[model samples]
Target chain A: MSHHIVEFKNVSFCYPDGTQALKDISFRITHGESVGIIGANGAGKSTLLMHLNGYLMPTSGTVNIGDVYLTKKTQQEIRRKVGIVFQNSDDQLFMPTVYEDVAFGPLNLGLDEAAVRERVDFALNLVNGLELKNKPPHHLSCGQKSAVAIASVIAMEPDILAMDEPAANLDPRSRRLLINLLKTFEHSKIIASHDLDLIMDVCRRCIVVRDGAVAADGPVMEILTDKTLLEENHLELPLSLQR
Target chain B: MTFDTQYYNIGFLDQLSYKDTFVHRLDPRVKLVVTLLFLFTVISFSKYEIFALVPFFLYPVLLMTLGEIPFMFILKKVLLVSPFAVFIGIFNPLLDSGQVFIFNGFTISAGWLSFISILIKFTLTVSTALLLIATTSFPGVCHALRRLKLPAIFVSQLLFLYRYLFVLMEETMRIVRARNMRSFGERGKDMRIYVRLAGTLFLRAVERAERIYHAMLSRGFQGDMPTLKHFQIKSGDVFFALSALALLFVFRFFPATEILGRFVQGVFL
Candidate 1:
């Protein structure tokens, strides 16, 4: 009863300033598959994540979410199935209060007050953020901000969850909490991060991005432990793996 | 140093707005509409009419007390904005010296009367506006703006500007801190580098705006911004609005201050 799939075919994106960001990249992710997108800095990992929900339309190819192909007209519809939590929680949590931020997506989906409230409560409760609902985004700690940002997207109930560097700003305890929370989500999750250990804990499969292209695609344990492949991509072995 | 203080000052008003008082509980639309009406009525008085504007002070003072906002906080903000009106009105006595009148047996020019009137109006209008935001949350006002049928784009732009102001300030603070740490006494203090920093900040701000737009789009944003706030114009709202308008009408039409003065004269003489 689920068609939760994200497929990119020969997709390429070129910035208007003549910079080619993502070149001929392609991937297919199925329902409930937790995939990690890893790369060195400026290797187009963010650009590739932007393509997942049709935020930046492919300059060359097509992106399909579930049964629908990504198009300008279908973007609003596609956004419902593919929720992308941006890297900076400040950018994502734009509403004044945590409640308003969590309720933003549901309200935009045209749900009535009761339905929006229910979804917001459910989403915030999932992140253990129900107590922080009335506070503004700027008042929250970075980890709390990150949780509320994810809850904002979760309120939409996207079939596929895509997050960019979700653990980039968290302390060890917060990162551990985030990893545990990610493991509990039933949606098909795609996370982009330099935190390889987090990817190792939460993702079953890993795709290595380098030079705006897929450098490797395989199981997480196999790819992450490949020390030579890690060095080639300017990545170090996960600190835990190295020890 | 001044930047840090200004940042906290902005948050102070927001903190005041979130207080759980009756004034804070009032509908923002009611407060917004009433404040605008108060401004118009206060400003509509003739330039030389100073005494009638005194009653308008009751509106803001009442709000301050009911909203649990400190008087000194509002007074400081009102005074901070007083310089512009003071500068403009200072010339009236020199320019319009004709039409002298007697006040407490002393001769004063109509220009002096108008100058004082301007000051009163400035304090009244500015304090009322400050009181409005002090009692009602900014997003509440934006929601009221949307419900009031103002353009959605404009309201959303305003909302985004407010929501992102702190984010932008934090970014700017980090940029400044990075610059300070890397430079000696004057190496990065040159005006040229500051110009370049402004350019870099502009570019970074543009990139951040794009990210925020993408985040909004991903959340099903389609031109119109919706709110989960359900406003009910309860009995308290109508009672507040009607009583306020009635007081404003009486003050605007009648010489309440002059009548009180004469009545006091009758009692004492």
Candidate 2:
């Protein structure tokens, strides 16, 4: 009954070219849960994450965000509740300045300028990106651009946060900063990443996807340590767990 | 320098707009309107009327100084585009044989005079356009367009084009670098490789566009990108616009450059 919960019931999606990206995928993410989705390339992890906010509607079955079902009509409302941070920070931060990019979502929601400004400041402050507000996205370092990308989404103040490969391109230091930043977020978080160590650090639960279906679902540490399961899905144990 | 570094720094004019100065502070709409008027006034004169257009150079010079934009940078950009204008005007002297003028006891063709006029107009208009962007951020200008009641879609397209120009250039730089590294000396930089690379870049751009669209949709983008109207037309905007028009009016009708020339002659002779 929690409004922040996300549930998928037998969801299946096929790309227009007839590639079945997600096959009968069902999962439930309750409030305050942090989950990591792991899979090999082309395993439909991204396609599945795209469903949370209805960026891609399930060709069959249903996705529920909080109290309402996700449909063409409810996607806009669902988007306000479920914020998505894409893998490429460049694609997400498209506006002229960091300030305008962070304000984009709130402005799209028809918020007034004062309200948008407040949200932008709060979100940028949360990610320590306030000083970068005037800089163009291109001018930002990869780490700064990623932080602003997160701020752009979180400015909507969504209940659930989903990110695709949030730490993929960061340096070790920037990756550490990202982990620390992610730890401060109390929203229900779903992350799809190849970084099992990041998953172990930030997410308590782990979902392993293979061939567009759930291969394993368990606690992060348990799944990350299962050498056979990880190997079967073309993954390896977290570096910390290798020895 | 490397290709990408050069490609990256080309947008330095855009960076210059972020600097705080008198020209940068004016409302973008005011600058845009006045610049259009200046361009129109410069091109309206007869092709032989070089003296009037000579004074028009002051506008870009004033803007460059006030905006703190590097004079040489704008001049370099102006020169970069000079070949196109030069090509178009080059045939004038050869085709119009009878038009001639006697200047300082040397016979000068009227075609030469007209070509010079074209060159002047070209410099004035192109440099002013560059200065306008150098002073006003592109988004500021796009917002001005929206405020002026231009189609919202057109403005949004311009905004995206400006923002993605760097993104596209970076993508091209990567592909070029990859090709360079793979090719031993200068092999892959050929036309055939370039044509194939263009196709690859186009496909990649299309994919990136899809992802960008998905990102926009996830953030509740309806159809149009709604820009917040925060630009207030302050008194300085009006004063700037009015004084610019007054100056343009005076220089347009009066040969200010010739008068200055005569004044210098009277003093120095």
Candidate 3:
């Protein structure tokens, strides 16, 4: 049987304000797949990613990581299974220094100091952010902050990496760096971004969300090249393909 | 100017904390305990005693020089927040009119002596606290607090407060700047405008906090945050603390400055 890293079955979520953020969303990410989630703002891309780690529970359907269903009891394990990098790097990199932020997850898992340090180093090196180890998160440039945020998540060695709008607000050079870095990851990745060029470069498959539901899901080339599907979801073709 | 001053103060201290120096290298717990001890000794002086407090100035002065901190920067920060201490001490001269001593052959009131004492104490305490933050980063202090047996909740609360202070200041500064740009003098300074600004800032802060909490949860954060940098107290730390304690003890009980001054006078005469 092919291993599915993340599986969401008929999942629906409604916020306390009664806003339906996710509606009957169902998807399965196989091991080593790089999938892109694309949607306009408030189309439930982030809300869907939240369910991957049990940060948000599906109001109606089941969410699972591997064979383990997401529940309060399995939350800690599920969190280890799925790592999320939020849109705002500032919100994600909360610890004072870059090293501490990267070690935060593993330490919380009861890892010893040596193990945590090793993981932190490995993660920072993975993102080419080892130089930022001693720098305070707030003092870093936007690009550096995003790099540290990714390192913080990757240090936990999660099975699947889920990032929301990973390319937003990035300069072209940093954005290109991020795309290249994501391409080198061996773990499955689920990225939500409006940067279609980034999606094209990093993701093999794409899923478009609209009105709290999945509008389209297919191979990256097919979904992104379908101008009618892209236009209907309030998204545009990648700049490279626009002409 | 007030907003800018506050913004600059926060950034200035944060930048200064990163400098490499002897004081910054001391274990945070040792620095914390030593600072507290120094504060107690300074504040324990009698209300009318001014001469004895002179020696205690060495603690901050030495820290400033040894730590390579700019003296004028700290002084400016102290003066900026000195109003409350001044307000409290101002009434002392008016309430007590008894004669005390002669200065420059003119009689001085006891009230003046006590008021001066208050001002001295204020400067000593505030400057030391500021220096503590300048030399030791806020997270270092929070870690020290946790290791010192302060409630985990209390330490975490302080950590959260310090972390958000920057975010809050940035948001508030933006709002203030926008108001300044759109309104002329006296137009943007209305109470109603201030009220609305505060309300919006509060709402945005709450939303930002929610986002932060979710981000934290996504990374497997449980109730307590764990730190990787565990501070180990060294021989240098012990030596520093003990020596400061001994020196403070001497400054507290023995009038070394006066004795030294008298010795010099007698020798010269």
Give the winner by DockQ. Answer: 1
Reference-based lDDT, each prediction? 0.90, 0.90, 0.89
How high is the lDDT of residue A17 in model 2?
100
DockQ of 1: 0.85
Which ranges of candidate 3 are over 4 A from the true structure? A1-4, B103-106, B184-186
| Segments of candidate 1 deviating more than 4 angstroms | B180-194
Q: What is the interface RMSD of each candidate, in Å?
A: 0.9, 0.9, 1.1
Tens digits of lDDT, candidate 3, A8-75: 88989999999999989888888899999999888999889888888888899999787899998998
Quickly count the clashes in candidate 1.
0
Model 1 pairs whose backbones collide: none
Q: Mind giving the per-residue lDDT tens digits that candidate 1 earns over A37-124? A: 9999999999988888888899998898998999988888889998998889988988889999898899888898899999999999
* Rank by DockQ (best first): 1, 2, 3
What are the runs in model 2 whose C-alpha is more than 4 Å off?
B103-106, B262-269
Residue-by-residue lDDT tens digits, candidate 1, B1-269: 77778788988988888789889899889989999899999999999887788978899889988888999999889888899999989999888888765766778787898899999999998998888888897888889989999999999898988898888887778888889899998888899989988898899999998888889889988798877788889899999999999999999999999888999999999
lDDT, residue B57, model 2 = 83
Q: Where does candidate 1 chain A have its weakest 10-residue lDDT segment?
A: A1-10
